[model samples]
Target: MDTGGGMNEHWQGVAEGLRDDTALLLAVQAEYRRLYERCFRDDPAVNHRLPVITHAFRRLGRWRVFLLLTPWMLARLLVPDEPPDIEIPADWRPAARRGAPYTMIGPAFSLELLTGRQKAHLNYSTAIGHYFLHPLVLAMAPFPTPEAVFGAWNDVIAARNANLEKMRRQNPQQEEISRREFFSGGFRK
Candidate 1:
């Protein structure tokens, strides 16, 4: 149970965790950038939300991260996160699909990849990493504009797909589902 002094302690623990967990920090940085561009760039209101989010993130653990994210996810579903309107060629073939409520592409793989690290060495479990750590990182970091974010996403997906096609050989050690599959709005096996 947490007393009133838990906020400072929680933040201290998070900082210590980040110092120890280089991979986790890197993953959080990447997701922070992505989410800022995708979700928070246009809305300056994100600035206001950050403090509350930070407090909640610090106060709660992994399960509560879901408590915060689930509502955001549901709101997004109700109001669909449509890409901004733009002129495009009618025949443009998208290289990768858009993400969904629970897609593994963003923070899941980073947090949960089975890299065989010892339990003691592991910085955070999937729930904590994705829900609390990633969001905390985003709240603290700066992000590019939404257009820049989407543009980068496209470039990354295209390059990755091209490279995957070029190097057709499969490596089980680095196996991953493509963004195309992830955002296909269909069931994955």
Candidate 2:
């Protein structure tokens, strides 16, 4: 349980986790930037929401909690992490215990996405990464504008992807796929 003294520290850890999870950062930021530019940029109150989101993100474990949804088989996160142990943010309001007439509404932020009219869509993996993990990273980072988020993560992902793509082809064992002699389908040589 968080006693408030470590709230900032808890979020800082989450921030670090996000930075280290390169695949997660890469997948989430691409889609997030597209959506922000297409959908939310026009909203007059977006600037105001940044702080609320930042605050909410720190509470939401800087998205480390949500990053667990990464596909175990395919994603193969480079910096895999056990979920960070952290308290839920204070802002989550629960329904009244058993008998209250009126319960306080929780903090609600309305986000619009995938409006059902678009042909292009986010895949399952990217969807999870975007909706669950992207916000917290955006919140915790020092981006002064929503668009800034794209450039920051974009450069990192591009560099890392380029490096990883090279790594896939170059085997350190110096092995090669050579022609086999007796392994033909039904014909032995």
Candidate 3:
């Protein structure tokens, strides 16, 4: 029931936040927890396997980006910048006729791969097929890529750190030691 709603007095000093920024960051974290739940929701080792499964998802995403999308983009360069293929006349026949030359058979074989009905893209993509059909490469990024959250955590942490820094910078007595520090050193009086 944590809505990340209104803050109390302790939170009053925080810098201005983006609309639902805290919620969004929490959502991103929740997405990871959901991923963990996907694999271990019913497992006995659910608590123990969170790190393993989350890392696996990150590895899968990197593999898809590097192994599938990178090469697919490169291979597409072989395609000439041309308009859609022209339609065939009703009476026209395919190039593969009986005892035809080997060169003529190439076009007939290409049809098996390209159905031209795909809608997958960079955001949510599969290299070859749809959900059940994606035999080779499939990537689902509902939130930020899990790997990216490791390095680019500024959106979640920067503001709070800035607030703490502001407090440290503006406090005139910061250079002076507090009574806690003074007493901790066993100073008399």
lDDT preference between candidates 1 and 3, better one: 1
Q: Model 3 segments beyond 4 Å from truth?
A: 1-142, 179-189
* Residue pairs of candidate 3 with colliding backbone atoms: none
The digit string of per-residue lDDT tens for model 2 on 123-148 reads 12212221122221323235564345
Estimate, for each residue in 31-126, the C-alpha lDDT of model 1 and write its tens digit: 545555666567644542232111122212121221112112211000001111222222221212123332322221122223231111112222
Q: Output the number of the lDDT-best candidate.
A: 2
List clash counts for every candidate, in order.
0, 0, 0
Better candidate number, 1 or 3, judged by TM-score = 3
lDDT of 3 by residue, 1-189 (tens): 111223311111111231133432333334335434554456543233113211111112112111111110110101111111223222212222222221201211121123333222111011111010121222222223334333333454577788888988899576466666776884666
Measured against the true structure, the TM-scores of the candidates, in listed sequence, are 0.22, 0.24, 0.23
RMSD per candidate (Å) reads 20.1, 18.4, 25.5
